[model samples]
Target chain A: MPEAPRTGELAPELSLPDLQGRATSIRDLRGRPVLVTFLRHAG
Target chain B: MKVRDRWDRWEEIGAAAVFVVFDDPDLIRRTMLTDLDVGALPFDVLVDRSRGTYTRWGLTRASWSTIWLDPNVYKTYARLLRSGARLRSAGTDVLQLGGDFVLGPDGRVVLSRPQQRDDRPPVGELLRAARGSVEGGG
Candidate 1:
């Protein structure tokens, strides 16, 4: 298991494909606050 | 879609949300159009096909205790059902857990919410967390 981010720690980077197959990254969304939610599945 | 309801609030705080899913692009695309009724979602939905991000972020699978023994899962399901969420066949790893995280402008973790079971992070609570982290006025 990788280290879980604590409340004050730096978040891990995320760069992945969107539905359109465009690469999106957390860094690309810099300068603004971000809300990242992981969904279990498409249930 | 609670987030959809409070989308203006998210805009007010100049923040955006990213939804990470384990499902493939095709499945998510279909679900977005058919089930979600949104031809285009307001937020970005990133695909985590390899689940590398999941493992790196310390999210794990649900155990027997977390799934079967926990009453909250049933409650959550009931809540979703009450909210018009249907019981559909899961397309990905059903055992894997989900999580929520809020980050400040500096990219530091503000709120890391690792789900204990089937419980999901409420949109209101997440909005509050983002306001606290971003606008300095929760």
Candidate 2:
């Protein structure tokens, strides 16, 4: 199990393909916090 | 916003971004056209393939009981349960449901929640959490 993030600790860097299949990476989200949601099929 | 309002408010928060990893191709199409008008969500909405992100994060929960122990997972489970969400898989498959995650720019996970079986995180709470990070207070 990956360790839950602690206060002041670096977050897990993630880079996943978006719905459009564009490469999105946490490393690219430097100036701001990134809110990533894993959603189920709502269609 | 009303608790039951089905609007996406991620666009309002400063630097607050929203990314939904949908495993279902059909859901991806629907979400794109859903017309969530709550707030200006400035983020990427994406589909997750290969289930790589779920596995890497170890977000697969063992049961509803186990989820309650983890606030992140429980929050999402409660929302789904309330919304009557169904999964593509059956029999204790955690990765098959909706999940929420809060990540810092440096790649640190601040909060992660699975879509609840009942209700999801209130827009107020989600905005508040994102606000904290935006102001560097979280």
Candidate 3:
């Protein structure tokens, strides 16, 4: 596993597809504080 | 439940809440529609089929013992079962762990909470951390 981004470090850019297959990136929400929660799995 | 409960507050604070799942989008959509009674989620739901996001975020895989032996896991399972949610054949990697992160407007991580068990960090704590980041501009 890669190192998790530490506080004060830039969040690694994430470009992933949403449920509707639309691509979304973390960089696009830069003007707002983003709370990103990673789930274990969809199940 | 935390995220869903505080959805409006998160938006009120000018924060976007995104959920990244390590599974295919179809499975996610199906599960959400069939098993959950909650209407559409208020925030974004991203699918990371390749688990690249997990690797990049340094999330570890839970050991078999960790999954089976944890009481919290059993409680959660029981609760879901009681709520009419049935266990299906696992389609994704069950061992993959999860975490929460609060990123500032500048794209820098403000808070990170890696799951130590089956549960996630409380939404209140996440909100507090986010509020602190916004107030302190740290």
| DockQ for each model | 0.82, 0.50, 0.74
Angstrom error of the Cα, residue B59, model 3: value is: 1.1
Which should have the higher TM-score, number 1 or number 2? 1
Candidate 3 structure lDDT: 0.81
- Model 1 lDDT tens row, A1-43: 7866888888898988887788999998887889988888776
Off by over 4 Å in 2: A1-8, B1-12, B31-42, B61-95, B114-119
Index of the highest-DockQ prediction: 1
Write down the RMSD of all candidates, one decimal each: 2.4, 6.2, 2.4
In what order do the candidates fall by DockQ, top score first? 1, 3, 2
Clashing pairs in 3: none
A2-35 in candidate 2: lDDT tens per residue?
A: 5434445575556776655677776776766666
* Cα lDDT, model 2, residue B79: 76
For candidate 2, lDDT tens digit of each residue in B11-102?
Answer: 45444465655445445455443565323334566555666666565444345564446676556567777889653332223325555567
Q: Candidate 2, which CAPRI tier?
A: medium
Question: Given candidate 1, what's the lDDT at residue B103?
Answer: 89
Tens-digit per-residue lDDT, B1-138, candidate 3: 768777787887889888888777677767754655423666888888888887888878889899879998889889989999787766578888888999988888998877766778778888887777788875
lDDT of 1 by residue, B1-138 (tens): 567788999999999889889887777766644756433677898889999998888999988676778887688789889989777776777788889999888888889998778777778888888888876632
lDDT top scorer: 1
Error of 2 at B99 (Å): 2.8
- Model 2 has fnat of 0.57
